[model samples]
Target: MGLFSRRRDPESPAEPFQFTVDKVFVVPVRGVVCTGTVTSGTVRVGQAAKITLEDQSRSVTVSRIEAQGKKRSSAAAGEQAGLFLGGLTMADIPTIPGNDGSIKDGDALSGASVVSVF
Candidate 1:
């Protein structure tokens, strides 16, 4: 399948990883912290992923995963957690398409999509 294709292999039972960002916080010690729900599949620390915002997509790594103040090895669909994104910074936050640098909320209007690259 193509990179952006949603088609799946019937023989494979794995669900594609997809996370919808609810809010974004840039921690001083940590990297970009994205709080959201796991839409599908599972994601683990050290896994590569693509953070999609509108027409833009950036490569990043899952540095850490936590839920309810407890660190987790992986998070599955329907679960809510905070994801520490590696290789990204405050400057990487998605801004309004044509506005003067206003950040977009993680809502359906223009939310961010974090999908596993592999």
Candidate 2:
């Protein structure tokens, strides 16, 4: 077995670790906005993209992420788009249940967290 490998003798099962990102998302000012299934968030700053496939749809990587949880904006979609937020993720809000690729225009994401993997 490897150093960090799991062992099984027909005894018990192993549990999984749950990693997530709880924040907001915004499009880059210059580039065209494309909405995808987020594809995957495993990609870091310099990485290509862990996941970026949409359901025959599109998604865009915004110029910057507007931190509303930081901006203190509990308002709807249109309202939360303008001002810049500061300590948005300060509060431990509930994260989105699953990864769905269907965020449409004017979608309400103020309290929605931006979960990522790797």
Candidate 3:
């Protein structure tokens, strides 16, 4: 292949949908939103996804996807985006235990993961 030529691997399979959550916040009208980068594959609005947080996991419906402050129907790998999850509230997130064994009363989804897309 030449220096400027692109190589294609026909034997390689496509990647599955995956995202690493960086932050989670609740909006008054939009409910819970998870903001992160889509690491692989694609995610679309209205698709069902599985979110994993530490040892916990929950199924949620994708209500909206936003990138660069604009709403989009779908998001692909390498895009920094936010996914609005339906039927999720701040109360549903698991609280981290403090050093004293008390539940921390702040943002509980800082390190969550969108493990699967369905």
Candidate 4:
């Protein structure tokens, strides 16, 4: 037997992997809908929401806008799971009128459609 060899530790810590969402949130729904507060009245149809590793961005349509109820669920960062966003091209991030220079996560948390996964 080689005495120079030593036993290796069988236990190893799991990876410190943290997932960051892209600048768009998409969900597979039967129909198209939009919901959110007009934090920026300057928003229009065909816009993109920029999400980064620091925060989340969501894509949305202007015309699909609707009022959200409290019964609906909210959107949060890294919350899109068990869904497939296929073949859906996200529009450009629309400009909000009174933007405070902060990225919007598309209030899925407030039942907003800002977090569209395409």
Please give the TM-score that candidate 3 achieves against the real structure.
Answer: 0.71
lDDT tens digits by residue: candidate 1, 1-118: 6789897545433346999888887777887789899999988888899887557788989999999899997889999999999976777664556566575443432257889885
Q: What is the Cα-based lDDT of residue 112 in candidate 4?
A: 27
Q: 21 in model 2: Cα distance from truth in Å? A: 9.2
The lDDT values for all models are 0.79, 0.26, 0.77, 0.31
The C-alpha stretches of model 3 lying farther than 4 A from their native spots are 1-15, 94-107
Candidate 3 per-residue lDDT, tens place, 1-118, comes to 6899988756333335787788787778778888999988887887777887567678888899999999997788899999998867677766677787655334567656775563
Position 63, candidate 3: lDDT: 90
lDDT of 2 by residue, 17-110 (tens): 1112222344344322212122222211211111122222112222222233342211122232322222222122223445574343223233
* Best-fitting candidate, scored by TM-score: 1
Ranking by TM-score: 1, 3, 4, 2
After superposition on all CA atoms, what RMSD does each candidate show versus the true structure? 11.5, 16.4, 9.2, 17.4
Ranking by lDDT: 1, 3, 4, 2
| Shift of residue 19 alpha carbon in model 3, Å | 1.3
- TM-score for all predictions? 0.72, 0.19, 0.71, 0.24
- Candidate 2 wrongly placed segments (more than 4 Å): 1-43, 50-118
Span of ten consecutive residues with least summed lDDT in model 1: 101-110
The superposed Cα distance between candidate 3 and the true structure at residue 10, in angstroms, equals 25
For model 2, give the 10-residue run with minimal summed lDDT: 43-52
